[model samples]
Target: MSATHARKKPFLRLATAAVAMVAALGMAACSGGASTSSSSSSSAQVGDRSPEQIKEAGEIVIGIFSDKAPFGYIDADGKPAGYDVVYGDRIAADLGVTAKYVPVDAAARTEVLASNKVDITLANFTVTPERAEKVDFANPYFKVSLGVVSPTSAEITDVSQLAGKTLIVTKGTTAEAYFEANHPEVKLQKYDQYSDAYQALEDGRGDAFSTDNTEVIAWAIQHPGFSVGIKSLGETSYIAAAVKKGNTALLDWLNNQLVELGQENFFHKDYEQTLAPVYGDAATPDDLVVEGGVDTTSTN
Candidate 1:
């Protein structure tokens, strides 16, 4: 399909899915008593006291991305700055503990949590069935969907258009699985980092790059000639913090914090302050940006 037609088709489908997902999430919130993470420990003590205990230990180590911008990145001054870092700070502050950031990559997040390398993970972890079965996720904080990007010279525009073309993606990401299951004919080039995959795309190593639309759009804006051809793909979910399994006390605390922060439009403010610069006026969904607490549940 041509770029023009590909753009039109997916947007229509995404619009439909967005509406349904929103309605379902809204209902889940109203019902309450959603399934809590099974990791909650029977012996885990709760209440504000938990945070107090952490603070007495002096610092809380958080896992975050060192290169993923607007979410987590080491700024020019050699300090972490981004939406996730900001949120991580807030969490530490609420816990009355000093926050220490541990830079992590895509493949190491789960291992870091499992090995207790970090007290919490603030990386851009998308909540999925497979991941949930391993690590426990807090309530949804930020929502994002996959996007297709290519140089302005390329004519590709949709998932189907890449049926026989090479597509680059970061290794161990949902994009790889999405294409493998839905568009198996598309040739894939996997890399370990976003920078590598994006550079490969710029160097003509692949016809296109696929990732969370938020990240792709940000990258395209930073580069002059590249553009995000397809903005939204399917029903990608929100980014949440993950803790080791059997840490229910920490999980509950994080979920409650998310809801409290949402009520005050913390995430909307976060986007405007951090992401809006790269995205401009037309970047995010108004509902998503302004969405007050989302339901923390296991259902759709």
Candidate 2:
């Protein structure tokens, strides 16, 4: 009756919130770069803020999820809780500045960065060839692939089974884009929030839902009736911090921070505090973590 086999979950884990709401990101054509590798750009094409400029600002605005949980979301105490939010704080602390958390959806991650609305996006921003042209990504810090969640009753076993089926997905997410490009036959019902997408799946609005496999696995565990049947829809991807295109100073600083933090295994500790609660022992840091802006999955 379940979709994903719990014993063999894929890498990349899950969720988010809202602050200073802005316009939603419209689906646009993207140019590709390497996805989730240790690669990054040495320069930016716009929004090049000097280190002094960032320092003088006394705060670094970080765009993060305000709805998806474990990875990012508003906690019971009405504050940000999740993996990305944790790093946002650390990034500010490293700069001796206040961490300003700006809530963003999957789609807004790029627009905010390119528009200088936020200094960076730590909201599960995956690297892709199309996305690379829009922003400069630092080294990837997490690794994940795609997954599909469907009700047990649907019996959806794989992505290929989704042909002609309407799958609900969060707006501006890679899922929507991926399906649009590669699986044009699969109809997508895009929602602005993850809850809406999950709701759509439950309400019979769509045959299934898809996103980062890591997240759907956590969701399948949390909500009993649903299961992540499709473990991986595409290639493994890296999750990296993204800054405005041409902001090499900020990009370098973020990359250096990742390398320094990796020495302390800070991301591991972060997983223990954030993701472990949701995934329990199902996911280890090495299963999905990328350290020093590099893919350690092969070695670890």
Candidate 3:
């Protein structure tokens, strides 16, 4: 070979060898990275826990209101105590797990479930089509309708009275949605917490407060100077346990649990124990309770 060609051949071979080494290293790094990623993804935990997983872990996280009395609340003992808590306890027991209660705000009900913060929400969660899009609702366990409570001195008996007055409402509740959609003329003073909304009403910041009929009635009974003027508003809605969307195992468990509990009249027993003291003659099981996920309103 010519001297020039001979010199070029060795340089080309060296360049080829260097390129091969770099390619091999690149392939090795890519393969290692892919293996590590696959392993990590398989081991990482995500999404809502299954019924089997909850039982295996020995605990089920339940979201409930810590302020809404007669339905869900923290009692004098500083423990979760109310109608929802009573039912939550039974649900945990039936599932062979401990119930860990988490206080959830009105607007965060669906969020808590979607974020996997709670396995079930029993916070008097009213069934609505919009909420159903984000979460799966179990068969209803209780019945409710909107109720407006106002001061005895200036009680608002009709929706017409609210045209110019500010009506207090807990944000993310059906009452807020109802009034906003139907009575836009009525200005609303919204609070994130039930306690805050009631406080606003008591402070005269708003002429009236609206929420679940069962809740307002119970609250009105306990408070001396307030009365539920509008006992029922909008369509009757049912309260049910909710799970993250696509959690079929947990949803099915809740539905089946309601049916099984119905056999023993579990909710009636719950009402008698948790709500009876507060509601007394103001409400009855037939009025607020749903047995076996069945709505007896039509039959009655």
Candidate 4:
């Protein structure tokens, strides 16, 4: 676990135990796979990997979260597993290449792409104007807003309740930026990983934890003592895969793939398989999932 990266391995069919394992192990990072093309050498100043180059290499390197569950996380078999992992697999399969997962933190999503360390980032990355300037975002596949969870005994039901209390947030997330810009009175405690942010909340180091509403809802359901009192805060945003700036070939490929897959309602099916079970009756697909590349609700 001290190593920064977990070696690549194929996901197993029986991955039900991965959630508990990832929770226990604190989301182990996965190492980047070797590039097959000279243009892809991480040591060199390279452009994003094109679809042809990836297919030629027989693998596509993807950046994803190794800690956040339902969306992205390491499975029991110690491989990348979760909704994004499943989607990444589909992307690779369609392109006739293997998926090489590189576990990433929220803050590192763009860095990995900018350095050509990862070809695509499917790490629950929300689209923002600032990030769009640094990376090219494909059409959105998911959407969300901010939400806050706190101990049920003293639940934070409203933003006004956070008057003098500390709020835990993962670094580089919309939640951190939103509070920093909108609510200066709220004390902020930041962690680089969602796992650590939740740990701070559990330890009573913060009055509440905030992040994507979808994530807080899932987490609150799993933890008996916590409740997501502020279910939705901030503007509705879309999550999409991102590539290095100006990587039009890869970006276009991703956008087209999303549209083609949308024709079959692929994302909704993905929800049934991965998210539905986790959410149970607490949530529904319509509340979240964006099918194909279309995001009717997106203001961005």
User: 60, model 3: CA deviation in Å?
Assistant: 0.2
The lDDT for every candidate, in the order shown, is: 0.71, 0.74, 0.79, 0.81
Runs of candidate 2 exceeding 4 Å displacement: 1-48, 298-300
lDDT tens digits by residue: candidate 4, 1-300: 211112112122223344345444333223334335444444433336678877767777788887788788766666666889889999999999888777778998899998877788999999999999999999989889999999999999999999888999999999999999999999999999787888789899999999999988877766667899999998888899999999899899999999899899898899999888667777888878888788765555
2 against 4, candidate with superior lDDT: 4
Residue pair clashes in candidate 3: none
**The 10-residue segment with the lowest total lDDT in model 1:** 32-41
Q: Score candidate 3 by lDDT.
A: 0.79
Model 4: residue 247 alpha-carbon error in angstroms: 0.4
> Which candidate do you rate higher for lDDT, 1 or 3?
3
Order the candidates by lDDT, highest first — what do you get? 4, 3, 2, 1
Best candidate, TM-score: 4
Better of 2 and 3 by lDDT: 3
In angstroms, how far off is 192's CA in candidate 3?
0.6
lDDT per residue, candidate 3, 188-239, as tens digits? 9999988778778878899999998888887776566788999999888989
Q: What total of clashing residue pairs does each candidate reach? A: 1, 23, 0, 3
lDDT (Cα) of model 2? 0.74
